[model samples]
Target: MLYVFLSICCSVIVSVLLKLAKRYQIDVFQAITWNYSMAILLTWFFFKPTIPSLQNAPIHIYLGLGVLLPLLFMVMATSVRVAGIVRTDVAQRLSLFIPLLASFLIFGDSLNKLKVIGLIIGFAAILCSIPWQKKTANRKVYSNAWIFLLIVFFGIGIIDILFKQVALFKEVPYTTSLFLIYILAFVIALIVLIFRVATKKTKFSWPHIMFGWILGVANFGNILFYLKAHTSLSKSPSTVFSAMNIGVIALGTLVGLVVFNERLSILNKVGVALAVIAIVVITIS
Candidate 1:
């Protein structure tokens, strides 16, 4: 339970940092790029994963995750800045439903009654989470903000599915696969950042690098503690899963409301509640 608590805190902290990034003028792209370097270092230090032969590795899954992870991270940062942490966190947690849908539609899993109900509610939650009003004079609010949330929902869901595939690739150690993916993602981010610097679209900033490493630590801590929670509660994967998602949503809402004073409409509030209920139903089913 301590691990679960820590994991939840780390997850929320990532959002908090991203939210603060805008206030501090941190370059999100440079921060994100350097984040992968820290992640790579931490992966090597903690996991000490053996380098696997590339010939037998699942390169396709690696390629997909390598590209998507960093890209979606930038999207998520944008979402937090624009949509606020509460909605962004809920959208991310609800994204688990995406893989569930894939399990039924693509992988031929049998859907239960509660799953059906959860899916219905989850979709509604997504729809309700969207800020559908016209753009306000407030620069913080974007018109059709749902696009960022939806992209995060689908992108993360697909990434989760790809990670599942990585877990199933018995030929390579999972940590090794993770290490490879981090390296690839860092490479991709680096290329883009280098291009931006070269084209004078952005300049090299020490602040972005420093903040990126901090973000990486929080991001890595979230994964590390979450995995530890699962290992500690090995007999109850469902408990860990439910607790992690529910905890993040609950804590994120508190932070967004109390700390940040993020505004949410009545519909968005209802969507948050439904998102929680949907998670519970899905877990129970």
Candidate 2:
């Protein structure tokens, strides 16, 4: 239970940190690049994943995630900044529906009644959670925020499915596979950073390194504590899953409303309520 609590805190804190990045003048791209460097170090120290032979490793999935993780991370940062934490977090949690949809449509799983209902509610939740506002002078700018939210919803969903593939590959320890994926992601991020710096798009900033390490710590802590929660409650995998999704949504809402002073419409609140209900229904079904 403590692990679950810590994991939830860490998850929400990541959003809060990203939310503060702009205020602190942190370079998000450089910070993200350094974030992977810190994550690699933490993955080694904590998980100590043994480097297995790469001959049978799932390199393709790793490469895909390597590309998507950093890219979507930037998208998520943008979403947090524009759409606010409440809507962004809800969208991320509800992304579970993507893999659930894949299971039914692509993997030939049965479309049971409960799952059908859950999916319907989940779809509604997404629509309601969108940060729809009245048409103002900057209506076009505000409307574009939803596009970032949509990208995060789909991007994270695809990343989740790829991670499921990594989990299915038993030839290597999951932690070891994670380490290699982090290395690949770091390399790609570094390449892009180098290019941007060379082209004078963005100069190097030391502040990004410090902020990135902090972000990495929170990011890695979220994973670590979540895994510990699962291990601690080995008999209740569903409990861990449900708690993680619901907890992040709930806590993130609190932070966004109280700490960040983010406003949501009545419909947005209803969507958040439905998102929680959908998680419970999906978990039980």
Candidate 3:
């Protein structure tokens, strides 16, 4: 449970850093690129993951997820910028359902009646936590944005499944898998950053680099502890799934409320409340 809570906290801190990036005039892409570099270096320093063992493991999963992480991140960025933050966030959070379902169907994880109820409530809580407002002005509809949102939703769920699959590998160290993916993602993000700068689309900034380091530490912690939680709760991936998602949404909501003074609508309040309930129920089970 310590691992679970620490992982959740790290996830929320990552979100907060990203949210604050705009206010500080930080280049988020650059920060993310540097973040990958920092994560890779830090992961090596602390975990010292054995690399050669990966040669015997499934290389495709590592490469597939390496490419998918940034692709999905870009999809999520487009979804948020075009659709609106609330919808994008809810869709992203609700993505746990994909892996949660896969847990039973693919991994043979089980759920009892209480667990099922908790999951249903957790889903509802995610929906409610995100506020929806009717557009006051009639604007052009871009169905493409909706498509991108679906891509992000399912795409992240697929990532979750991949991570779980990696955890199942008895031979490959989870940190080694993460280290490889981080290197791949860094290469991709570096290329993007360089191209964007060369095209005069973005300027290099020091603040972004600094924030990226901070983000890297937190992001690495998030993945490390999350993977550890899976190893800790090996028999109940579903519990960790539901708990992690709901806990992030619910606790992230509290941070936004108390720390940032963000206002939540009545529905959002109800959703946060239910999120708490879902976490409690799932934990007890």
Candidate achieving the largest TM-score: 3
The lDDT leader among the candidates is 3
Q: Candidate 2's residue-wise lDDT over 1-285, tens digit each?
A: 688779889989987988799788888889889988998999999888998778888888989989998888778878867777657766786786776566446544565688667667766766676666733343233568899999998998787567656654668876787788889899999998999999998988888889999998998888667656655654444345445665576567768889989787898788779877776675566
**After superposition on all CA atoms, how large is the RMSD of candidate 3?**
1.7
Each model's RMSD to truth, in Å? 4.7, 4.5, 1.7
Quote each prediction's TM-score: 0.75, 0.77, 0.94
lDDT of every model, 2 decimals: 0.77, 0.75, 0.85
Clashes of 3: 0
Local accuracy of candidate 3 as per-residue lDDT tens digits, 91-204 = 888788799988889888887999899999999998887667544244443677789889988998988888778877778888888899899988998888889999999978
**What are the clashing pairs of model 1?**
none
Clashes of each: 0, 0, 0
Q: By summed lDDT, which 10 consecutive residues of candidate 3 come out lowest?
A: 133-142
Residue 11 lDDT, candidate 1, scale 0-100: 89
